[model samples]
Target chain A: MKKLNYGIIIILGIISFIPLLWVFITSFSPGNQVIKGGFPFWVSNPTLENYVKAWETAPFIQYYFNTFVIVFGVLIVQLITITLAAYAFARLNFKGKHVLFILFLLQLMIQPEILLFPNYQVISQLGLVNTKLAVMMPYWASAFGVFLMRQTFKQVPYDLDEASRIDGCKWYQTLWHVYIPSAKPTYIAFALVSVSHHWSNFMWPLIITDSVDSRPLTVGLALFAQSYETGAQWGMVAAGTVMVIMPLVIAFFIFQKQFVSSFMHSGIK
Target chain B: MAAKRKKFGSSSRHNLFAYGLLFPSFIFLTLFTFYPTLKSFQLSFYSGPMTRLQFSGMDQYKEVFSDEIFRKVILNNILFMIGTVPTSLFLAMYLAIWLNKKMAGSSLLRTSFFYPTIIPLIAVANIWLFIYTPQYGLLDNFLHLFGRGDTSWLGNPNTVMIAMIFMIIWKDTGFYMIFYLAGLQNLPRDVYEAAEIEGAKPFQMFRHITFPLLMPTTLFVMIVAITNSFKNVDHLYIMTKGGPDNASNLLLYHIYEAAFTNWDLGKAAVLTVVLIVIMLSITAFNYLYLDRKIHY
Candidate 1:
């Protein structure tokens, strides 16, 4: 039974590994070899030519920059907004709190991504289309962040809150010194989730931005790969795919424990 | 009387402070979410460019409902959901259960499955697109061993949905597996010990004890999966562009085509309304179910 269990898991694991393995292998294989493909297990004459050509083909450096700006822009704004909002919801006895909380929940239900058409209109009217701000703006107030942080903040010892208040700390100061410090794990988890999400976000960015100045790696990769549909440039495409995924995948491997637990933290509570 | 008056005054101060704290989030929520949703609803009732003023009540909705492509798109979304969600759920649960036991190389096994979850869907779509490419693609090359080599998986209408479904199942199963892993960790060990003492078979223990105890996680994960079916159409953009005669078109991608590609804002508005309704209902069901589960 144990052997059978191992056999099943290892087989499934290989199945899981194949696409990634193939992409990695194909990225190094020559164009002729790829064209001569038959179960691309061996790269007899491996080269970095595909990576060079892919880097030269698209302005990936610019894409990396735009992605960084947008991802961090969204995260910084979200951290502030969610922190204050979560504090209010968790600690304050405000009027209409339930109704207001429900309003926030509405964002969770009807995510900004799904409101693409209307959101595009808003960005256009604000004259922010084709800009990183447009990509960053809609996600600034993350309801998911607020919801997750509220759960964390609520668990903070009430005595700490009282003590902070007794020390003549203003509400914001108390939040900074007490609530934020106590909810460090939640902050890390939410930041990981948010950063990874915005890094991977595509459709809305695809619609909103038309220039390389604002297009992230995913959009750039899509445009680059789509052009190769009629041309069998698999090696370059694979290289580009690898480049786009490598950073996050590497970060994930390095912080695999943190990444797994962060995801679990997002879901379980 | 003085103390009572002081309490009342301080409570109002607290209210103001709370509102001050919530002010930033509310501004953004109103702008990008609430207003746009309301705008979509309003636009669905009218039929003209953004500047033109005309009210054609229900005409947009009627047109969208009557449109052939819209029906195909909605049906494709349904089929994609039915295809990916349950299968991924079962696979995820099975993998989680097996890996939960103490075993050598389990960490490696876990990483192999979960790594895909972190990769961007667009990148995933690109990788899978190559895998599904015709003749010289990895899939065909692999199948050449079995004497089946020539197939345009994404180019044929008959096979396109299945092709997209299989790719999605690969991309998402690992993600859903993590949730099941988390759920498995939280299940009481004593119940399983008790079930073993009672001589219950492994399958029986799973069918009764583990599955029943993991009901809340199942429901939560189910909600995430259903919503994902609607939200995640990035693959469609790369794999087929909802092609092979719209065989694999989903609602969100359809809306993208209507709104951006075709610049048919009115039709897109109606589609948006339809999507919003679907999303709202799913989340509503989730909240209601989760609310009930909380009490248990």
Candidate 2:
């Protein structure tokens, strides 16, 4: 049983990582090797030429900067709004709070793709077209983040709230001191999820930004490969693809336990 | 659990504080989600651009329902869901069960299974694009072993949706596996031990014990998968773009072309309403069945 299970695990692992591994190897293999379908499985003559060419061909350094700005930019704003709203829904006793919370949760039901036209209209109306902020605007308020944080805050003991009040801590002070300190795990979980999400978020960014200055890595890489700029050079395409996803991949590797456990925490909750 | 009331007349001030805390999110949600959703619904009935609008009740929707391409898109979406969700769910469940066991190298296996979760979908599509390339593509090369290597996976109408579904399942299964993994780990061990002591077969044990316990997670994952079937169209933009006489055109991608490519907001709005209605009905189904059990 153990050996069979192990065999299944090995096969599954290979299948799961094949695309990533294939892309990585194809990036290092010669362009002709890729065209002849010989490089993905093995790279006998590995080279960095594709990476160099892909970098030279596209302003990937600029794209990396723009992508980070969009990812972290969205992350920071989302943390604030969701934090405040989560705090409100979790702790505050207010009239119509249930209705508001339900309304908030309703956002989760609406696929953002359905809102593409209306959102584009709104973004352009606000004169945010061709801007990085435009790409991040609609997602500035994340229902999932709010839901996660509200659940986290609800688990905090009311004693802390009372004690903070007794210590003359204002609402904001209590939030920063008592609540935030205790919910560190939740915050880390939310941050990791949010960063991963925004880093890889492609569609909205694809719609909103037209130029390299505002295009995130996903958009940049997509355009590089699909828009006929590179014209089906798999090696360069693979290299650009690797460049786009390397940050998240590295982050996951470094925080493997945290990433898995955080996912478990979020899913179970 | 009630604390001492500070001042009875401070109700308004307390309300003020609460609303003040909630202000930013309220504005953002209203602008992005609530308002757009309402406006999308309302605009579904109207015609033309924002500057020159006409009230044509149900006309847009009528056209949407009757259009051949729209029908194809809906059918494609249903087939896409049918193709991707159940297979990925079962695959995820199998992997989750395997990973939950305290076997050697299980942690590595778990991480590898979730490799898809971290990568971007667009990037995945690009990688798969190369793999799906005709003649000399990786898949074609593999198919050569079986002596049938010339299939244009993405080009042909018949295999296009299946090809798209394959990529989606490959990418989406990991996320669902994580959810199932959580559900599996949370199950009580005593019942399983008792079942084992009672001489239950592994398959029978799964059928009688594990599967029932996993119903809630199954329902939740199903909802996630259904919603993702709509949201996940970046691959179409790269891989198919709903091509070969609209064989693989899903609703969202069709709407994208209508609004952006064809520059028809009215039709897009109508399509958006259709999408929202389908999603809402799914939610309504969940509310009626799963939501009650979810909390309890």
Which lDDT tens digits does candidate 1 get at residues B1-296? 99999999999998998999899999889889999999999988888777894899988888889999988998889999999999999888988999988888899989999988889999999898888888788888888889986999999999999988888888888888889899888888899899899999988998998888878778888889999999998988888889979998999999999999998888999899999999999988877767587455
**Fnat values, candidates in order:** 0.90, 0.77
lDDT digits (tens) for residues B94-150 of candidate 2: 888888878778888777778788899999888898788887678887888789958
CA lDDT of each prediction against the hidden true structure = 0.90, 0.85
lDDT by residue for model 1 over A125-230, one digit each (tens)? 9999999999999999989999999999999999999998999998789988999998999999999999999999999999999999999999999999998874
In terms of TM-score, which candidate is strongest?
Answer: 1
Deviation in Å, model 2, residue B147 alpha carbon: 2.2
Q: Candidate 2 regions off by >4 Å?
A: A1-6, A37-40, A227-232, B1-8, B293-296
TM-score of each: 0.98, 0.96
Candidate 2 collision pairs: none
